[model samples]
Target chain A: MPGIDECLLEAMKLPGARGAAVVDWTSGLALGTAGESQSGDHEATAAETAELARIAAEYQSFAPADGSDWSDDDTPVEDLIVSSRDSYHVLQFVRTTFDSSVFLYLWLGRTEGNLALARIRLREMARQLVLG
Target chain B: MLHRLAAEKATGSLMRERGTLYLSDGQVIHAESPDTPGLDVLLTAGGALSPEQWGEALTEAGPQQLVGRFLVDRGHFPEGALELCHLGALYDAAFFVLGRGGGPARFRYGVAHWMGAVRPVPVDAVQRETSRRREMLNEIWPEDDTDTQPLVQTGLGLDTGLPRRQRAVAELVDGVRTAADISRALGRPAFHTLVDVRRLAAAGIVTAARRPPRAANAPTRLPETSAAPDVSLLRRIKNALEAL
Candidate 1:
């Protein structure tokens, strides 16, 4: 599996891929971060974004109208996208048997980044991530 | 034992059945689980990166060094904020990792991290707080399987005595909107909304199904914990479990 450094380097190769972080959403911690000249606080942004994702995911699971349909095991998150005029915030939770509660967070300049490509890169990075 | 390990300021990896979660100085930094979507999903879901980018990144270079270095070198997040984000992510991930049942969890010490510069402020308070909230969530919902399951509300009964947030959420869910959609619709900060959700679930205004613990699953024919306790709440819980 790819180590933290290798993953960040790979992410930067993406078009307009501004910044990336391996954030532990469970505790809102940034495991590793990369890229340059960020616009805001990377760690806080990561924590906040993770918070948003968790709330969004949990809310989706607990909404009232969903009582009759509680037969399944968990909810599927297609994505949690929060966009500003020039920036896009992403929080991806990577689930492996080793650590199920962590996520990898990425931030990009909306104008410079290719959203679709960035997502694919992050997914690939997650698959190769080894926690130790 | 886990708490004791943390108190020892251990530096090592905690292994779980599904995956592994890493911790430094009792602060969790890395976690991987098989049951839920990994970091890629969180990133893509937020629309920062697309599937194609993930694929290309993988093909062009390995995922390890590339993703890690990119996060630190890119963007302009302040130290305080970055620290906050890191702490939040750790706690959120821990909520799922440490709480998983039916598995053996082991912690091996003496692992040093070269990426300590990337580490943020400590997350002791935040983690403790999240754990408390998780307990409350469990008290109400009593199930770990709901993390990925589709949420359903049957337009059940309720009283006006509930908190406004709870009332609002209940009313909204009663309308058949998914919980995720409601969270987006509410547009409130996630932390506040989630606390309210926990309250609603614990109050029985919301429900999820799970097999009760042996303590709770005792048959009606079995002797009770106390035959005539003056407490009414205990009686109520006992009644509920008996019905199950």
Candidate 2:
């Protein structure tokens, strides 16, 4: 029920959360953003992180060994976690009804953020995001 | 031209040969083109909403210029799904509109689309993304023929382990679907379709089929999104998957 802004605001309430964005991995655009971005520019962060998301989503090597079939609109790989020295970057793939190319990106500080909680919360958020 | 309009804080539609840009207070609120699928197609055709649902929503809210709000209020999905698709469709069409510069255009002051304002983009951002997208496509494959011309599988063979999207693009190549056509078929952004086509071309998986010359005034047909579902195409895909 939470819209992009509301969802992002909710993300900001997470411990150690610094910034959040809903990004399209295909075109590298930030559809919506909240909090403070790592690079001080949400668009730049979106474009740069999209490369990583695309790599993970599209590359065959990232597929599961079980070999379950997946369409382009649905990436089997759910979330990508990149940890830096000071913070954790979490990219959770959001499923839409059509062309699910978006992911929720959360930038969290290492000291205060609970990685497990963020992962669980983001998955639920991704699952519930309706606008297909 | 659009930049000047942006400076003037113009509100209306900038009509061009390729597409139209809907500006509100100098910001781009919407855009559409013959070369790209609109939000309705992106939503319904892409399987986010059924055609019936879309038809109903349009019938109810389109006249009020509140389809975006209607979709949001309906709460079928979660939130921000419309915005994501809206931005994608807007940028896809705006790319074509931006390309039509240096030509005569018909600008109407105080025009707006029925979808209402989902989100407005700055003139600078749209232009920046358009150029970047152009460069990105060129970087993949310089030729633009695969974009506008009918596509046929080269049958020279495709690389193993192609990405899922490119594989879907590969499946639809029967010498009739252009990149735009395939975008309509797949219900994704035209830019994504073109990007996939260019990559497939680079991999020798698909190629643009040449057509005979036509007279200058003979208009090239645009893909009709309102057409009934392509049962044959779906059948072919279903059969192919079964065979595999």
Candidate 3:
């Protein structure tokens, strides 16, 4: 599995990828970062994205209502995507045995970035991203 | 002191009252403390391994100085999970070790932790991460005393908006158990539990007893009792077994 730095480098290779970071949503800390941050401040972006991820993941409404058991194995939500006129921000949750509060944040330039490709690639990267 | 050791490319264990940090070529390879659960507790308490499994691994690899490799080779857990847990335990212990003020620290050259090295982090990185964690707590709630005191609910019904983790922490707050105690009870990392408790305090969802004043001229001698069994002899026994 690719570690945080390797995964982040792979993320930066995605088309129009401007910046990428592995953020622990629980602590709002950036585990790794590459390229220019969308918000100029990587720390601020990490904290903001964590807030968004926390809100989305904690709400019961985000999970499927089929009366299925709620567990870490069952991801409450997949990737969270936010788009502005000029850019796209993607937060892909990474599941771990201990906590699932980490995610990959990718900022892409809208004019050149492919949202669909970034989303798919980020999900794949999240699966392979190793934390140590 | 660590910076000087790192500069000299020193090897061995730095023993303090709160914990022990193993360094190899100036890099931190392992750490353990009584205040925080070690890697063994993290794995077992987190339900990653049974006590029997851990004991077996210890028996097989503790002497060989390859317990980390043994677990991975035996498919007990993935390399990633092992490293993550090891790192978590290391930092958690390091936090207390660093915070232990005025205590004498002893360093023995060429010593090693029985578990061996899963991953070695730079001395600087460990220090930086510890400071970052401290800053995070301060940013959330400026009061440091709340960390050591037993938690008490405000009884103001202020928990309606608490997150699941914080709520779980709140439920464990019996006005008796401190944050570290609750952390063990929940099988969560001490640092993470502190973060949650700080958040709860920041939100006025919970309150902590007033911190007592420290005595002037308190002796800096290392505490005689530790929270966990001493594993030094186990390492020696394992060494003998490996020699056989």
lDDT (Cα, 0-100) at A32 in candidate 1? 65
The residue-by-residue lDDT of candidate 2 on A76-128, one tens digit each, is 88899999999999999877777647899999999999999999998877765
What lDDT would each prediction earn against the true structure?
0.52, 0.83, 0.77
Q: Model 2 Cα displacement at B176 (Å)?
A: 2.0
Ranking of predictions according to TM-score: 2, 3, 1
lDDT by residue (tens digit), candidate 2, B1-244:
7889899999999988888999999999999999998777888875668888788788999999888888778864444677777888998898888883526777899887888888899999999888878877876666678878999997766666888878888888899888888888888899988888988876657888985566899888986785676554554465457546
The list of candidate 1 runs beyond 4 A from truth reads A1-132, B1-12, B24-27, B34-37, B49-66, B76-86, B100-102, B107-117, B120-130, B138-150, B157-205, B209-244
DockQ of each: 0.03, 0.52, 0.26
Candidate 1 lDDT, B117-214, residue by residue in tens: 24432445435544665654555445433333234443446664453445665666543444444444543223333545555555555543332336
For candidate 1, write residues A45-77 as lDDT tens digits.
Answer: 556666776565455353445431211322245
TM-score of 1: 0.42
Which candidate order results from sorting by DockQ in descending order? 2, 3, 1
- TM-score per model over all chains: 0.42, 0.85, 0.78
